[model samples]
Target: MSELLQLIKQAAMEQVESSKPVAVMIGKVVSAAPLEIQLDQKLRLTEEFLVLTKAVVDYSINMTVDHTTESHTHSHSYQDDSTSRTTQPHTHNHAYVGTKSFTIHNKLKVDDHVILLRVQGGQEYIVLDVVGGGIL
Candidate 1:
């Protein structure tokens, strides 16, 4: 029946409108502390609704330096009954142990453009990375 087909179509449309799987959007950071991002003129997301990635957050790492070789050249004078002098080059192998810290990323700032992934159900957005001319 025509009415039955129309009903099915209307129900399908309603279901599509109500279900949100995922969405990608571009947003501009409006505030840093207690971050705020503006998706549009009418929609702005705050920290509570956002999840940040390592690329947009201040991240640090520690590294270790191990065994290494060092070379040095020096002259040694040896005086024998014959009075002779000699110079030699020496190579030294040393075990080096040290910790190095590295900063992988910097936090986002106001006016920065970023890419965001809208999580399913549309309740939260994950900040993937900073884009354009920004700290990224």
Candidate 2:
């Protein structure tokens, strides 16, 4: 009975270890107007990173049968900038070390959302995404 219990515990431990999510770092906000962010280390996204910029709101609005009141709403659109570059696949080595820059051509305001993903390699990290955010 003790041996059987030990086997079960080992299996459970293995399952939990395999289900852990990878570590992700929130990069710094670079060029708020252009919406650029610098990561502390390079990031390799499986797919193209999706960034959404939104405006910050203070309150909201509500209407009643007797009277109406105004509030605040937070919302923004994804604007395309002429300088925006499409997602590309590339590899780099230690030689490419240094602060790398990625520009979000679209005009970004405060409180915008930036989503990044690894669209290509299964578990391998891409060279471009593996840079330090401070370098930018």
Candidate 2 lDDT tens digits, 1-136: 9999999999998777566654344444444544455444564222234323222212333333332334434444443674544444434333333344443334333333333332232242222232232232
- Model 2, position 51, has a per-residue lDDT of 29
List runs of model 2 lying over 4 Å from the truth.
1-22, 41-48, 53-136
Which candidate comes out best when scored by TM-score? 1
lDDT of 1: 0.86
lDDT of 1 at 90: 57
- Scored by CA lDDT, what does every candidate get? 0.86, 0.40
Cα lDDT tens digits for candidate 1, 3-36? 9999999999777755977899999999999899
**Could you tell me the lDDT of residue 110 within candidate 2?**
37
TM-score of the candidate numbered 1?
0.62
